[model samples]
Target chain A: MTPISFPDPDFIARQTAKMLLEVKAVHFRSDEPYKLTSGLVSPVYIDCRRLISYPRLRAALMDFATATILRQVGFESLDAVAGGETAGIPFAAWIAERMGLPMQYVRKKPKGFGRDAQIEGVLSEGDRVLLVEDLTTDGGSKVKFAEALRTAGANVTDAIVIFFYDIFPDTREALAKHDLRLHYLATWRDVLAAAREGNHFPPETLAAVEEFLNDPLAWSGANGGVDRISV
Target chain B: MFDQLLECLNEQGAGVRAYDACARMARARVSEEPDNAAAYLLLAYVAQRFVESYDDQPLSVEAASEEFQQFTDIVKMLDKAEADASADARIAALNVVAAKLNTAPKTGD
Candidate 1:
C-alpha cells in the first residue's frame, strides 16, 4: 500500500476523523455520559482500538501517522518505537515496522513477579524511542510510559497517538514540562467538524457535544462526574 | 521459535505471522520474567491463532464464535495450570517462548 504522502495536517486530521466515523468507532452519549479514568464524565468516547479489525483503513491511518511523525519529528531522529501497555502495542508494532525501528512495550507497572520487567521487548540504552498509543485524553499515560522508557535508558523525547482529546489547555504544557512532544492525527475538534459536515448526528446532539468540548470539566461537573482531573 | 512461526506465517498466512510475532515478543518477555498466568495467556493467544486456518474463513458467525470460544477455553486452562504448579518457576514461561523458536491481539475496557 502506498503512503498518502499527505503533507496537510488539516486534511489528515479530517480524513482520519471521517474514517473513524465511518467505522462507527466514534460514539456520542451525552445523556449517559461515560466516566473516564481521570474522573471526567465525557459525552464523547472513541474506540481507536476497534480500528485493528479493518486492515486497509488501519494501514492508511498508520501511513498518515508515519508521515506525520517523519514530518514533525524528523525521519531519522527516532531509533525505536515503544507502545504503552495493551492498547498502544498494536499501533506501536505497525509504526515500528513502517519506520524500520525496533518495537517495545511498557507495562503500566512491573508484572510484580518473575522477571517483573515493565518493558517487554529488547530495549537498549540511549535508543531514541517514540511512545505510541491509540489515543490520549489528558496525556497522562504518555508521561508515565515515557518515564518508564527513559528510566530504562531509552531517550524518549516524543509521543504519538491516533487521537488526542485536546480539550484541556494544560495537556500540552504538562507534557512539555516533562520534555515530551505530542503528535497526533486527529482530535475532538476534527471529529466534531466531521460530524457536523456529514450531519452524522442531530443538531441538538452535536450542540451538546460542542458544549462539552467547550468546557469538559464544567460539563462533567454539571453532569454526574468530577469537575477536575487528578491524573 | 520465531523462525518456526515466521515459516508458518510465510507458508500459511500473514495472520499467523502477525499473531506469532506478538506471541514471540511476549514469550521473550515471559522467558526473562516468569509470570505463570501471563505465560498461559501467551499460549492461549497463540493457540487461538491456529484454531482457524488463516486462509479459511468460518462459514458463519456461529463457526467463528466457536473458534473464539476455543481460545477462551485455552485461557481458562490457566486456572488449572496455576493449581498444578510445579517447582520450576520458569518452566511455563520458558515453554511459552520455547514453543515459539520453533515458531500473537486484544483490546477493550
Candidate 2:
C-alpha cells in the first residue's frame, strides 16, 4: 500500500486561489459596489456555492481540505465532521468521506426540541467534531454552530472553512473567544495575489482590489459602507 | 399536503390564471395546514411571475414600483424557509419552483 501525500500549504493556497478564479466564483466590482444582506457595501463578493458545479476542482479542494485537517490537527484528533447548515453540508460530506469519519450537520435552528435538536447525525457525547463551512467573514455563524454543538454535548475546538475573508482583524479573536481554532485553505489575499500573477483583470481593477484588501474597513467606510463589523 | 396543492393548482385551469386566484388557494392551504412554507413560496413565485408578465409593457416608474411591492410582502417568509436546513425545506423550495413554472403564464423567451 502507498502512503497518501499532500501539497504544501503555500502550494495548496495558490492552487485553491487559482481554482476559485478559474471558476469565476470570486467577483470584484469596486465601481458598481454590491450591497450585502448585512447592509454593507463592498467591492468584493464570493460564491463558494458555485464550486459544487465543478466536480474536478471541488474534488481537488476537498483533498486539500482533508490534508490541511490531518496536518494541522493530527489524524486522530477528530471523531466526526459536521457541516454548518446549508452551504456547508456537501463540503463536510466530501471531507468526511476523505477522512473516513462520521458526518453530521448543525441546523441554523432547532427543529423541534431535545438535546440534539440542531444536530442531524448521531454525535456521541464528548466526540471531537470539526465544523465545516463553505466560507466565513466575521465568524458569527461559526460561533452559533459551535454553541449548538456544545449544547448538544459535542467537543468542538476547531472549525474549518473553504475560504476565509481574512480582511476582518477581529475574526480570529472572535473565534478564539469561543475556543474554536479557525482553519481554512485560502483567503482574499491569496485570491488577489493569484489575480495579479495571472493578469486576470486589468491593472486598474487589480490595483483597486489590492487597495481594498490592504485596509478593507477603511476602504469600505470611505466608499459609504460600514467601517466596523460586529461579531 | 402537496397532493392537495396540486389538485387546487389544477382547478385553476387555462386562461388568465389570475395571481389573485393563486393567492386565495395558497391562503386556503395555509389555513388548513399552518406550517406550509411551500404554499407561500409557490404563491410568491406566482406573484413574481405575474410581475414578469408585464416585462415588455410600457409600465411607468410609479406603476412598476407599485406592482413590485404587491408581491414583496410575501417575500419575507422566503428567508425563513430558505434558512431552514431540513430536507423538507430543500424539497419544498425545489417543488415550488417546478410547480410555479408549470402554472405561471409564460411571458418571455
Candidate 3:
C-alpha cells in the first residue's frame, strides 16, 4: 500500500467542503428553514451520509480522515477505532482499516446487560479508543458516546468527525469537559467558503445561511424554531 | 454486526468480497428463518449497489426500466418483511433500511 500523504489541514478542509458541495450533500434554504433535532432552525443542512454513495469522494475523504487522525492524534496513540452507532460506523470502519486497528461501535443505548453492553466488538480495559462520527453540532452526542465508552473501561480522550458545526460557541469547551479532544476535517465556514467560490446558491440564500450560522439560537427564535437550547 | 458489513462494503468498494459478505449474511439469515425480511432487505441494498456501480455508463431505456422495477420489487418485499418480522433488532434494522431507501438518491438524479 502507498504511504498516506498528509496535506495541510486547510487544504483538506477546502477539498472536503468542495466534495460535499459537488455531491449535493449540502442544502441551503433560507425561505423554508430546516429544524434540527436540537430544535435549532437554520438555513443550512448537511447530509454527510450522502458521501457513502459517491465511491471516489468517499475514498478520498477516508484517506484524508486517516491522515488527519494520524497527524493530529498520532499513529500509535490509539488502540482501537469505535464509531458512534449508525452514521459513524462506516467511517470508523474505513479509518480502522487504514490504521490497521481493531474496530468497534458504540451504541446510542445499551443492549442486553453488562458493563460492555453498550459497545459492540471487543473493547479491553484501558484501551485508548478513538470515537468517529460523521459530524458534530453541539458535541452533545459525542459526549454521550464518550461517556459510554469510558464506562466500559476504554480510554476515549479523542473523537473525530468529517464535519464540525464550529458555529456553536461552547462546543469545544463542552467536549473538553468530557475529556474528548475533537478533530474534524471541515466546518460550516469551509462549506460557506466553498459555496462562495462555486457560486452554488443565490447571494441572498448564502447570506441567510451565514446569519443562521452566526447566531443559531436567535435565528431559530426569529424563524419560529426553539429560541433557547434546553439542557 | 451490520456495522461490520457496511465497513466491509465501504473498505472494499463494490468488489466481490463486499458482495460475498453481504450475500453470506443474507443467506445465513434466510437459512435461520425462511421468511426473514431483514435479510432480503440487505440483499436488496446490495442490488442497489450493483446499479450504482454502473452510474457512469449510459444504459438502454429498457435496461434502466428493468433495474428500476427490480429495485421497487425488493423494496416491496422489505416492506412486507418489516410488517412480518418479530424480533426487535430485525424490525429496527428494517426500519433504518426502509428510511435509507426512502432517502436514497433517485437514478440519474
Candidate 4:
C-alpha cells in the first residue's frame, strides 16, 4: 500500500459529495422539514456513518484522507490518532492503517469510571494528537472530543472530518478558542455547487437551499423554524 | 552484541525476542534521527510479536496486561514519527500481530 495517494482537496470534496449522493447518504425533504436534535429544522440531512458499510467506497475515501492529512499536516506531525466514538471509529482505523499510526477512540461520555474512561487505548502526555470524526455540524462536538483528549494528556491541535456544515460563521471561532484546527473534505457550499452542477434538485428547491445558506436564521424564521440558534 | 541480543530474545521466547529486536532497531534508527517517530511504532511491532505468540505460552493474565500496555504505548506514538515507508510497513505488520495478540487469550480459557 502506498503511504499517501488519492484525490486532491477539490477532487476529494467533489467525489465525497458524489459518493454521499450515490449511497443515498444525502436526504432532502421540502414539505416536511426534519427537525434536528438541536431543534433546528432542515430541508436536508446527511448520514456519513453509513459509509463504513461499503468497503470499496470506504477504502477510497480513507486513502484520500490519509493523503490529505499527510500533505497538509506533515506525515510526522501527529503523535497519535483519536476517533470520536461510534461513527468515526472505522474511518479512523482505516486511516490509521494508511498512516501506520497507533489508533484510539474517544467516547461521547466517560465509560464507567476514571479519567481514562473517556479514552480507549494508550495515549502519552503531550502527544500531538489528531482528532478524527465523520462530520461537523457547528463544530460543537469536536471541541468536546478535543477537551477529552487534552484532559487525557494529549495535545489536540488539529482535527479531521469527512464533511463540514460550514454554514455557521462562529464554527471556526469556537474551534479556535480551544486551539483546534478543523480540516474537512467538503462543506455545505460544496454540496450546493455539486447540486447545481449535477441538477440533482429542482430549481425551486435549489433556490430554497440558496436562501437558507445565505441567511439560515432569516430563512429558518420565515420557514417556521427557529429564528435563532440556541447554544 | 547482535548475537547476545538474539540469544537473549530466544531464551525469553521468540515473541519476546522479536519485540526486543524491533524495539532495539527502532531506537537505533530514531537516535540517528531524533525526528523519527516511526521508531516508537517499531517498538509496538516488537511488542506485537510477543502478543501474536502469546497464545503458545503460559503467561498470567496480569503479565499479559503489562505486555499489552507496553505494546499500546508504541501505537500511541506511531503518528509522531518522521516518514519512512519501509519502517511504516514494518510497523503495520507488527500491528497486525499486535491485534491478533489482543484477541489471543493466555490459556485459551
Number of the top DockQ candidate: 2
Model 2 stretches with alpha carbons more than 4 Å out: A1-3, B1-109
For candidate 1, the lDDT comes to: 0.73
Worst 10 residues of 1 chain A by lDDT: A108-117
**1 or 2, which is superior by lDDT?**
2
**Residue A141 in candidate 4, Cα distance off native in Å:** 0.5
Better of 3 and 4 by TM-score: 3
Q: Which stretches of candidate 3 lie over 4 Å from their true place?
A: A1-3, B1-109
Q: What are the lDDT figures for the candidates, one per model?
A: 0.73, 0.74, 0.75, 0.68
Worst 10 residues of 3 chain A by lDDT: A222-231
Worst 10 residues of 1 chain B by lDDT: B55-64
Per-model DockQ against the true two-chain complex:
0.02, 0.03, 0.02, 0.01
Best by TM-score: 2
- Order the candidate numbers by lDDT, best to worst: 3, 2, 1, 4
Docking class of 1: incorrect
Two-chain complex of model 3, DockQ on C-alpha atoms against the true structure: 0.02
Highest lDDT: give the candidate number.
3
Chain B TM-score against the true chain B, each candidate: 0.38, 0.36, 0.39, 0.32
